[model samples]
Target: MDLQSIKDPSFLKKMNNEELEALSADVRKFLVEKLSITGGHIGPNLGVVELTIALHKEFNSPKDKILWDVGHQSYVHKILTGRAGEFDTLKKFKGLCGFPKMAESEHDVWETGHSSTSLSGAMGMAAARDLKKENNYVLPVIGDGALTGGMALEALNHIGSAKTDMIVILNDNEMSIAPNVGALHTVLGRLRTAGKYNWVKDELEYLLKRIPAVGGKVAATAERIKDSLKYLLVSGIFFEELGFTYLGPVDGHNYEELFENFRYAKKTKGPVLLHVITKKGKGYTPAETDKIGTWHGTGPYKVETGAFVKTPASAPAWSSLVSETVRRLAREDERIVAITPAMPVGSKLEGFASEFPERMYDVGIAEQHAATFAAGMATQNMKPFLAIYSTFLQRAYDQVVHDICRQNLNVFIGIDRAGLVGADGETHQGVFDIAFMRHIPNMVLMMPKDENEGQHMVNTALKYDDGPIAMRFPRGNGWGVPMDEDLKQIPIGTWDVLKEGTDAVILTFGTTIPMALEAAEILQKQGYSIKVVNARFIKPLDEKMLHELFSAKLPVLTIEEAVLQGGFGSYVLEFAHDHGYQNIIDRMGIPDHFIEHGSVERLLEEIGMTTEDTVAKLKSITPKKQKRA
Candidate 1:
């Protein structure tokens, strides 16, 4: 069977269970081989092969909507819908998206990259379908881990209560990014191992009826006894209570089980929750054995050896630097506590968790809860370090504004991956945090120029006891700079002058600092004296320095690896305007549009944010002749 020749899932209608199983095997092989070169969510995709096949075989896609919750597991869906040939360029620039894209095919009804959004999206689509008097099934395949999300639970409440005709596929794999936690995980754990619920219930009812009701008497006592025992054994009781027709503990790998449950779900009226048990990384040995979620996604690997492609690190990752520094600081400060929303692995907080198990918290994909939970700790005079990715923190903006900032609580937010986060595309980009965080009152926002400065800033943020503060750090390794032997606190709201010049000033920080330095050196070689300033504090503009630049009437250029509007550049411009300094200024950054998936360097080049562009912008802004007296 040529996998690449697959045009659509329509071909699945004629195929029997044996053929579908074969197809699943073929799909797994294709994914394992293809993704070895171009890395992706191989573990998740491999888990869903049979389930996806059975879905297409049973239901009509494009017409019958199948919404993948996070979309990382939609690779099998993509291949069945004629995207197998595109695997070579998957997640590359101008290539197949890593997540479901509505633009890619009509089959992709609901586009999603974030978790727990599918049910809500499904409800909207269901409502629209009813309004238009159209009949079709809306199945939202959500993970057991996603059910912990506040939004998903809300949607479940609404959809169940409303008696909407839809199928909520509960794909229970015991993992999501990392191993799931909380009460929901416990419930699902019971559900996974709980044997023959109906048979046990029948046996219990039979025995209870036969046994005398010991003084209480009759069928009412017997019924009560049956009810009590049923809940303890029945996993579907949770879904049934929520008004969904509880269907399975179906084996996701078996086409027969998947097809049988999916059929039952389709015929059933109202909301049907088909609890399908899946094994994450079912086909491959290495991924199957992955315990720490290292194989959730990857950057290329060896197919034969299952080893990751080589990239000898020159420096510790930015996440490691920030998290390790916090762990070091925590040893001395008993008030310090660490929290992440299901990103202990991603944030490199494993060491912290290992050392301070009681002090560390893995909140499990609840950003809003994590934010307020950290705030609650802050109220107790406890230093809560809320480590969250910049993109995920957006979901908790209200908590950040209302609970954290309004109360003037001292919470240190480690804004991880705080720039254009490449391959994960626009959904995962950490570009908007500065724009959103700076405008909030009593918020101190900053980014460090290098690994040394990053660790110091981490120290600075933790020590600061006034209101809320955040330190944004980029993805991947640092510049291999020597770390200071002792942790030191940088002065709040101060900027560092990297190079001093009288003609023109280049204001930049974090990832763009090197670009600014390179651009300035190039300009100096071309007989122009240029000044480079590390504008570390984003919210508090270097006003005194700005005043000096204004008095000198030096042409200024601001560079940032974020959106130009409402960004660091805008902050500088705002300061200039407030003081009424009519200075010639130019801002270089990502424009008002969303940047797509690509290598960071390529994305920077595409947005004209490279050293060459910086030099060009500098040349255009500065006066031709430098008369240095």
Candidate 2:
């Protein structure tokens, strides 16, 4: 099949089964070639090729609803849905998105990037269909890894009780980013090994029906026995008990088998779960064996050698600093334990995991559970350091407030990537932790100005043991600063005046500190003496120094790589208002609207967070001397 000729899913549907298989092979080859240069989600997209093909072939997409969980695996779906030509521009600024965007196509029912949301979205679509008296299938292709989430479980319980006519495709790749962890994964493992019992039950029903009058009652009795047999035969009894008719342990890679299973599910009345087994990196050897999930989503690489291109590993990332600091501290303090919600690699806790295996816990993408679990561990005299991304921590805000802060539990939250994470765009930006966490009672929210400060804060949080403490750091490398072997604890809730000037002051935190300092240097050359203060602690706000800004009667600028509303800048304004100062306050940070994809440098410039933008704004506020006429 020629690549140019097979432009859309409708083309593949017109082809016979054998021709379709050829087309899939061609498509996989195209993906491997294009992805090697473009750098996108290769492994997940590779794994879902056959499933996507079968789904598009089986259902009329625009008319029938199909929602993908997490949306990382939607690359294959995107290709079939007529977005294949855009693969060259994947994840680039103003190009194709990495995840499903509703504006991209009518076929894409939901815009998703986070995990465990598809089930609930599917239920809404299903309910809408029932309301309109429309006969259309609502299918949500949810990965087995996502089923561990509390929301997914809740949706499952509701779907079971309501008995909605919906088809759920459980794409079991036996992994999610990392080797899946927890009891839910264990249950699925047992079920996968046991295979589907649908055939055996059907055979028993056929044999009993042949027995005549007694057979009618016997079939009814078999139904009850089958309900009982579920617990005996499989561990997926939890899903079945919820009222869903269990369908398959079908081969997701097998196009014919997947199509048949999908057909069977479509014919069924109540909720049906079609469990299809697949490999994470299907058809690609390197991805198939990738255990760390590095190949899951990445930059341009060599497909032949599976060698990622040597994009100079910039300065040591802040995540690495957190990981190293935690590992060093854990070695000294036996009470310290590390926890993350399925992001050990991304959080840079691989070393900590190796050093303190028992003390380390990967809570399997359950942020709410991880926060509560950390609180529970803290209560038992164990200091649990939860390493979570700020964006994901939003999912567990209530737990952070209720279980940790309100109860005054000693849980150290290592908030990694606590600012604008470029390229992955809005859904992934970690820019709200400061605002959300600041107001919580007993919560100490602090972001470091440098890697050394980050390390010091980690030590401070561990030592304090007062209540819930959070330390946020940016996504990438710290500004080139020397490291010291000896650990020092900076006094908590204190701000550092890096440079003193008379004209005005620049107050900032985390990633924006370097930008603030650079802008100060540029302004200093223009004869405008500017002060730079590293406002490390966002919650406490360094009351004395903050009050001094008003006391000095200087014009002020607050910079942060976060939204302005209810953020660091807002806090500065509130402080000024309370102090009754009329000093001009200028806010320079991310705007209220969602930012788009680009390189970090490009994004900073685009959003006017760079030194040039700050200098321009500062010049606007700087008063020109009155004419000497």
Candidate 3:
């Protein structure tokens, strides 16, 4: 029988074991073909086909809320939940979202893109269910890597203590975007491989229960023995001791096993931990062989060969520039050491990892620990470079404020992906780093116009060991600008005047610098002389420059690729408000609403971040000043 013939939702309930196996294979095949064109999380989706199938079969969604951690693995869930038709437009503009979308379907109860959040979301839903007298299962499928996050652990602690009626399907793929790290990962690893010893131990305990009145005493003793042996056999008694009902190391790929475990979990109550073991790339050879988690997300690729169709740009990515620059500096300076919270490959620290393996720290998904650890390193006079994504660094805000900034440690934070990250959407946007980082005391916040400036900023941070320093750079390639030969360190609280004009000024930084320059050129063409200033230091505003511009009676238009609320615009406004400047001031950037997935160019244009928009808006604002003829 054709697998596609089984169309009804009820058909999944009646599917025999063999038919289920065939269906899983068909789903994998369909995913490979569909994702080749659309280009999504192919490897993760392939890994979770059986788990997703089993989940839908066991629990009714929309009524029974299911939260997918990170949501990258939800392609299988989406395909099964009546979203298969829209899969062709995955991650495309106004099309199917790569992650779970609450707007997309009723089945997707909670929208998620970041990791380690589903558990907390699940807890909240479960609490609401109790309060509302709703009878439904809330299953949160969190990966092992997500479990390492402090929030996930905190959620786990709450669930364990609250004794909420829920099931947490621990999707152990031994990875989370990158390979898993930390003590928790080691514990899960031990549990995944503890099948043999656990089985033998269980059989012995079962036999011991056959004894008489002494059987009760023997069983109690056996329970203790089993608990001790569990700790001895595996590294993870951590979950069990925390008050979760540990279930399995069951094969997630096997439909029968996954279905059986899920069925059992559905019946069980009070936070059942169903540990399902899955491979990151289950069927695809290339993904299976990939160890660095490159296949976690990708653009279009050849299905048969698993080769990426388009080549990466000849220009080095911002990540590569930071990594290469830092690696070079670290090699020369013994104080420089690199640190990341499980983002070695994404941050392009592979070269640093190879050259300075001892100096590099992959602290898993524990961003808090990574920050504090860096702070501790700083205490020892070692220049710890905590290289993290701008969004991800938000996870360590408390640590930054409390641990490092509070103590005034000399920790260098290389905040990568620091602007409007395109396809990943709002949750991944690095926009608020400046706003957040600038607010902190004893923190030097800087953004570079190009790769050359990025390199110099690294040197600047290295040389300036007075306090904590943060330098942010946007995602994707630089404008192919060559580096300075002397590597002269730019002074703190300084702005570079790219285009010297008298009428108006376009104050900007990083990726927006090029656009600002373009806007200035457009204005210059139309008889509007506009000055373009690269506002390098975001925190300590260039007061001298601002005073000079205000004295000259030039209108200032503050532009950025970040959000308008609490952004560079707000900073400029606050500065002007304090200084009492009478000249006209305007702010331009992404609006307060969450931006959707699209190309950076497309999204920028749509958000009125282009040179044309700036020029038009500036012309409309100035209006030739209405000079009397």
Candidate 4:
């Protein structure tokens, strides 16, 4: 079948199971081909092909709302909802989003990029439906890994207690980005293996019922035995006890089984938990064999061989540099330990974990718990290095402020992907960390000019004992600068002057430093003397240096790859106002809007953070007298 001919999933209802199976194959083939060019959540979408097909066949979307938790697995849903045509530009700017986007189609009822939010969304929709006196199904497909999240558990508790009419499709793929951890995973594991127990219980009950003349005390004993067996056999009784009608560990790939369970769930009263098991990368050989989540999401890959199109890095990845440095420090400092919120691989902490297994902790999608756990470790005088993504760190804001910052615990927060992370788009962008982290007291926020400075910053953060310190680095490779022979500690709240001039000063840090330098160089050729300084520390503002710049009466341009509000530039403006300095200052950064997925260069250019923009801003702020001279 021509997949593009699918305008909506209404046609799916008319097709037989055999046709649906063929459609699933075609969909998988299309995804494998298209995603190989555009790159996306290939493994996840492949896993959900049949499940999504079964869903479309079972329920009407838009009318019957279906929410995808984390939404990366919504690719198949997108395809079924007549979006196969947009695969060529998947994850590109203004193209097909990797996750569910409501604007893209009416069928996409809810947008999600963050994990563990679907249950709450589904409950809201269900409540709305009930209030409006409408009859429609509300199903939230959530994974076992997402179930580990505190919010998902909270939503589950509330939904079960409220007795809201909704079907919770527990898509158990046994992995979320990485292998799931925590006790919840263990529960799901037991449930995954409970198929045999279910069969045994069914056989036992059948035999018990067949026995003739069974009555009174013997019947009561048999009933008690059956109940005991049920309690022993069914692993989902925990969900049942929570007031949900728990259904099978159904085969997610089997259309008939999925359709049957889904139909049963829709008819059931109150809330129903339809536990369905799926393989993460069901069809593709390389993705199917993915043990470490490399196939969870990916860049473009060769279709025939499954080899990723390689662009050899000119420098080391920032994550590796920070994690390796931390590992090195852990060897010398026994007090040092590592922690991540289910991102050990992303944060490049696998090396650290392998070397110091006892000291490494992947807290499994619980950012709040991870933050507090680090704080607890810090209270015992242990140096806890909490490596987390900049976006995810938002989830632990209260913990960072109330626990770590308030107590002035020595927690080294390695804020990986601290700027505009491309491809994954707005929800995954790290642009808000500066605005969020800078406001907290005892929080020292800093970025580095390059990999060399990044390592030093990591060293400085681990060495600092006064309060919680954060060293943020952007995604991808560094500038390939040579490393120092010996690790040295950089002074806190100090800025580095990369280029010296008198007419104007360009203050920037991290990924934007090169742009600032290039802009300054451009201004120099145009007869404008511009100074470039790496304002590495976002907070603390290098008061001494600010005083010098103000005293010199030089115009300043602050550039950051972060949000403009309450960001580094705002701090600079605040500093000038506090000191009663009349220095002219201009800020260049991401505007007060969400940036979409694209290449980093394209994103930078889109937001006008390029060298040309920087140069223009600096030229505008150049001292009038100096310009006239």
| Candidate 2 TM-score to native | 0.96
Instruction: Write model 4 residue lDDT over 1-629, tens digit each, in one string.
Output: 99888899999879999998898899899999998988889988899999998988889888989999999999989988899888888888778888888889999998898898999999999999999999999989999888899999899899999999999999999999998898889988998888733245445767777778757666557757866876877865778778787778899999988887777776778998998999998999999999988999998899999999979998999999999999998899999999998888899988999999999999898999999999999999999999999999999999999999999999999999889889999899999999988989999989989999888888898899898999889899999999997889988999988999999998889898888888877778778888899998888789999899999999988989999998999999999999899999999988999999888889888888888888788878885433333
Q: lDDT tens string, model 3, 255-301?
A: 77777777776776678888999988888898888899989888788
Evaluate model 3: give its lDDT: 0.85
What C-alpha RMSD separates each model from the true structure? 3.6, 2.1, 2.7, 2.6
User: Which 10-residue span in candidate 1 carries the lowest summed lDDT?
Assistant: 195-204
Q: Model 1 over residues 1-629: C-alpha lDDT tens digits?
A: 89999999999999998888788789989999999999999999999999888888899998999999989999999999999999999888989999999889999998888899999999999999999999999989999878899999999999999999999999999999999999889988887787534345446667767766565465667667766766766764787788886766888898877877777667778998888999899889999898888899988999888999969999999999999999999999999999999999999999999999999999898999999999999999999999999999999999999999999999999999999999989899899998899999999999999999999998999899998999999999999988789989999989989999878999989999888898888878878899999999997877887899888999899998888889988888888898898889999988999888988888888889988998899889887965334
Model 2 whole-model lDDT (C-alpha atoms): 0.85
Ranking by lDDT: 1, 4, 2, 3
Give the runs in model 2 whose Cα sits over 4 Å from its true position. 1-7, 214-220, 228-236, 625-629
Query: Residue 518 in candidate 4 has what lDDT?
Result: 85
* TM-score (C-alpha) between model 3 and the true structure: 0.94
Model 1 residue pairs with clashes: none
Give the whole-model CA lDDT for all candidates, comma-separated.
0.90, 0.85, 0.85, 0.89
As a whole number from 0 to 100, the lDDT of residue 395 in candidate 2 is: 97
Q: By descending TM-score, how would the candidates be arranged? A: 2, 4, 1, 3
Better of 2 and 3 by lDDT: 2
Kindly list the per-residue Cα lDDT of model 2 for residues 1-629, writing each as its tens digit. Answer: 55544455776567667877887788789888898998888899889988888898989887888899999999888877778788888877778888888888888889888999999999999999999999899999999878888999999988989999999989998888877898989888888988675556656667767877855668679877766766666766767778887877888888888877888787778999888898887888888889888888877889898898765754688899888888999898999999999998888989999988998899997999999999999999998999999999999999999999999999999888788887787788888887788879898889888887778888898988788899988887887687777888878789999989888888888777777889888888777778999999998889988777788788999998888888888999998898788999999888879877767788887788788998887877766433232
